[model samples]
Target: MATTKLTLSVDPEVIAKARRISKLRKTSVSAMFSRYIATLEESKQRETPLPPMTKRALALAAGTAPVPENWDYRDELKDILDERYGLK
Candidate 1:
């Protein structure tokens, strides 16, 4: 594949974190940024609400044993999946 180099300024802390993650994953910073940018662009195309989930409802769903007032089931479900898969 053809490639090109481009330079841009970014926050130092963000670059440091990206570099750390890139090294941990054995990939180049450019590649990591490319993937991240691609995902962000893709998300921009989505039109749905992406499943509603309030923070208080999420806590109850995780078996936190304290269902906050006006809890919603959607949050509970998202919390369950996030916990099981470490998606967070």
Candidate 2:
């Protein structure tokens, strides 16, 4: 892969933590950041479902919820019309 050089800024505390971890693992801080970014990207690419919400949290959001039994989001837009101007 072609690599590009870039600069980034991070908190001093975070840099200190990364430096400690690198020292323990005998790796460079750049490698640690690269691995961290790669792991995050891999997780994003896998399309993993988000963690489940607590029942209390669910109940709180349900106050304004739109979903009812046997609701279909795809068909909800079929009868709606939108007009756009000055494009294309």
Candidate 3:
């Protein structure tokens, strides 16, 4: 791909730090900025899909579990709270 030069105004201290880091990494400052910009562009794309474990859990929960008849979660939660907190 063709590349275009971009002129940016940055703080002298920030440029100095970037120069030091790039020198230590044995890469040009422009190359470092290119990599950083590429990373930002990649992140702007769609996020990664859910992991395998999460996908499997969701699939198993979707109409696969047997729920007991007349099961009220509110009553169950109240009972649990009463037992734990000694509330009437």
Best by TM-score: 3
> Which stretch of 10 consecutive residues in model 3 shows the poorest summed lDDT?
59-68
**Tens digits of per-residue lDDT for model 1, 1-88:** 6889999999999899988999999999999888989999999888465345665666558875776799999999999999999997
Off by over 4 Å in 1: 49-88
**lDDT (C-alpha, whole model) for all candidates:** 0.86, 0.78, 0.92
- Please report, as a residue range, the 10-residue window in candidate 2 with the lowest summed lDDT: 79-88
lDDT by residue (tens digit), candidate 3, 1-88? 6778989999999999999999999998988999998999999785889999999999989987677899999999999999999896
What TM-score does candidate 2 get on C-alpha atoms? 0.50
Q: Could you give the candidate ranking by lDDT, starting with the highest?
A: 3, 1, 2
Give the Cα RMSD of candidate 2: 17.2
Per-residue accuracy of model 2 over 10-43 as CA lDDT, tens digit each: 8999889989999999998888888999999998
Candidate ranking under TM-score, highest first, comes to: 3, 2, 1
- Candidate with top lDDT is 3
